[model samples]
Target: MRGAPTAAALTDRLTAQLRRRPVRAFWTALGLYAAVWWLAAVLTQLNLPLDAVEMLTWGREWQLAYWKHPPLPAWVLDLLYRLGGGSHAVLYLASPLFVALTFWAAWRLAGRILPAPLAALAVLPLVGIVYYGFTSPEFNHNVVQYPFFALLPLLLHRALAGTPASRGVAGRGPAGWSAVGRERDWLLLGLVGGLAVYAKYSTAPLLLAVALLLLCHPAGWRALAKRGPWLALGVFLLVAAPHAVALWTIDFLPLGTPAMRAAQAAGWVERLWYPAWFVAGQLVNCLGALLVLAALALPGRSEAGLGNPRSALGFDRFFVLWMLGLPLAIVLAYSLLAGQELETMWGAPYFALLGLAGLLLLPRAPSRRGLFAALGLAVLLVLAGLAGYLGKNLFEPLTSGRGMRAQFPGPALARALEAEWAQLSGGAPLPTLVGSFWLAGNAAAYGEQRPPVFIEGRPERSPWVDPAALAETGALLLWREDEAGRPPGWLAAWQGSLCPQGELVLAWQSWIELPPVRVAWATYGGRHCDRPPLAAR
Candidate 1:
């Protein structure tokens, strides 16, 4: 039998493996991260996050536009809905998968720009980023943009470096890729860049940044001079053209949302205050990353180039400024100029390339020890986030008798509502509902019928719920229980004939000991509601 390896030998073997196959280690880490977070999220969160639940309400409509955003996110959610056979829990996995894809894109980008082991060193610091960690479980349009943001830069970099006359030039496209391959990269850049905005209109800043890069930067200027940019623009228009159709068909319905006004500058002071507040949130979010950089750069350490990686070169310098800085500058400037108070989460995708940026700050690649230090800090940060997540999500419900939306008793609520609807509708399929996205959405998502919610009872918000269509099909009218358990003024107007109504007090899911959920509900055009099972009161 072979003798057991020495500790030094084992260490060397592991190091060699990481050197040879960092991608494997990268994937293994992501897998573990996803698995742990998924289990924890499932355990702590009985109901979906608000955005996710809201997406479900939108997805069933299969519309090209929702009131708040574009269709790509809804399209993805709709696909997941069908794949899960209507199980909303499947979305719990999407955020993780999207996050992994973002990380993978970053890794791919690093490889294209930097040499191997050094490339692996830079990516480890990303573990410290809050956007990629604590908030990742809640898949939304922001989460969907994760991969798009990372991949777009990667594709653009390849295209810019691969244009004609870039052959054997510094920062040229990866070796062995022919001119055709470079052209293909441009096509992909256009496709992905277009889809980024399709995923969210907020992605326009990045697109604008790309345009500026082409206009001003050397590599980008060269690429623009060739067939690459034209081809890219053509493909971009082709990919994004449908959204224009979607907008026209919808008559620009998003302009009608009150939330649009809500996000705008409320007062003259808000221009300064809003951007400052947003910047502050982003800084706070990136502190974990800062810590990783600090660890990687501790002075007097044996780390190969801990505090000093090689300075970024020609295109790399441009990439940092335009790709990283310009998009953010555009957003802040717009917020300042237009008085639009930006959501801080809009900053999430901007930092996926942070590790690549780190190389520029440090003079040389960090030694393996330094890389490990950064990775270890990341692991600690993730654990801290987990503890915080569980504590907030669980401790409040157990200790203070308060429940977050994550702790909502959705399945229990759905089951009770479904059974009651069956009796009331006499098996008519419980066609639809109108209420708050959270309340009605939970009911529809888990209910066997899976009816679409007409959010806030507005055709503009839920355009699929045309009053004419609903008049033919009929819908359930429901809302959360106010202190007085009263209907809204709109619903109370009673334009349509109604049936008997009742309340549903849903027991908490799993071991959550909080007070049950209470929704005031009624049948507008369904069957039997006289003998209600849910509303004992």
Candidate 2:
């Protein structure tokens, strides 16, 4: 007991260290994020998630807009892929990099709301949230949106408060127009806001929230009336112009996609249910996050030192309510009215402010004991998330029956298809594949064939494939294998309709399993291949 420090002594030491070294504390948090995610990425190298594959395939095409989503993630991935010289390992860095920037943004915002050590403490709960760790490896649009979302409020705060040189550099923007003082911050906000929108239309809620805040708060209204807001709006519009043009040229193709159409057709009951379901999903995801913050609420040594939620005043209170809360409310309201189900991943970037909210709502400044407890909870969750991810990677295949896209043997199937094509066409370019996006995308990304994918057996989705050339060059049509080793029942019927003269055969097949699973493949058009020639084997 002689060497054991008293509780008060230990608390004093930790508080002193944390308060004296806020920057070091932030880097420590960021270091944990990078190490944990990078380890998972390296260990999980055998397979790429569906979203990551989609980004890779779309990145290959360098398209202005993808069929289902905006182009930012694809654009960035494309650049990263090229920069990585086609190394898949480079893709792993994407999520963690964005997450680090997001955390930095959150930390900066927290500094404005709390003392240095407390600001660092504020971010711990958020870092433990699963979205920033487990789900981020996919590095989809949601992950891409994280930094922008985190940066938006911070920029808005600086612009609104006329706080100079705190959030962004003061200078002339891309338009070659110099903005000094308040206008500089507003200009940068516009740019960030515009880029966020380009990243995903979901960012509209944040922009809407900003608008509401300006209307509701007198100071915000005054700031908006100045040249800064207008300049910001102009910059935003300019940044968004290309996407708008792309949408127009295609008649807003995203709105007409099957998913959107299905949502549009949902009834009133479904509409109400969708947002309710989304809110519920958010709660589930935030369980670990909430637990970390709850630890901060435990009674500490001094009541006055414990910050109260009601103690938040002026801009901080407005920020918690409008900046953080309003966007979520708008998303829920829109989902309910539209009856369109929001995917759980869409909520990934929306909670970057959770830590700031946690700090502002505390009735008193956190005691050292509470701070350490919250950090412990956060570290516990981070370890759990990492363990779960590793377990899935290690044990998932052994169990079988699970057909996660990552577990698919895309490279082997691709090799098999290439050999099959060489046998049939005497080694011309593999040309194209007519199939659903998932199968075709995997083949293109991981398979050596590098054939273009015509989604859903339709040519329109693959504009890069020349219709005439594809006809001459031939194609492989594929579908997922059913439980019984046959193609899915509906695909079997479609195959019959597609090749009335030809029979669907198990042209190529591959398997992977700690337990054992297989994907079935078939050919449709090849030079040496004849129609209706093969019996079902």
TM-score top scorer = 1
> How do the residues 1-537 of candidate 1 rate in per-residue lDDT, one tens digit apiece?
999986545545545656777677667777888888778777787788888888888887777667778767667777888898876667777888888888788888777666665666667777778898888888888888888767888888777655443334643455665553378888998899878867877688889988887887666667766798899899999988887788888787764543455477778898899889989998899888888887767653444322234533455655755677888888889889988777888889788878777765775556556556666677789899888878877776676667777778777777888887777667667777888888888888778878878776777788776776664676777777566866566565433455546678877654666666777776654334454333333
Candidate 2 lDDT for residue 227:
80
lDDT for predicted candidate 1 compared with the true structure: 0.74
Q: Which digits, one per residue and each the tens of the lDDT, describe model 2 over residues 424-474?
A: 667777767767667667777766545677776544455566656654566
In model 2, the worst 10-residue window by lDDT is 501-510
lDDT of 2: 0.70
Worst 10 residues of 1 by lDDT: 303-312
Error of 1 at 267 (Å): 6.8
Candidate 2 lands at a TM-score of 0.83
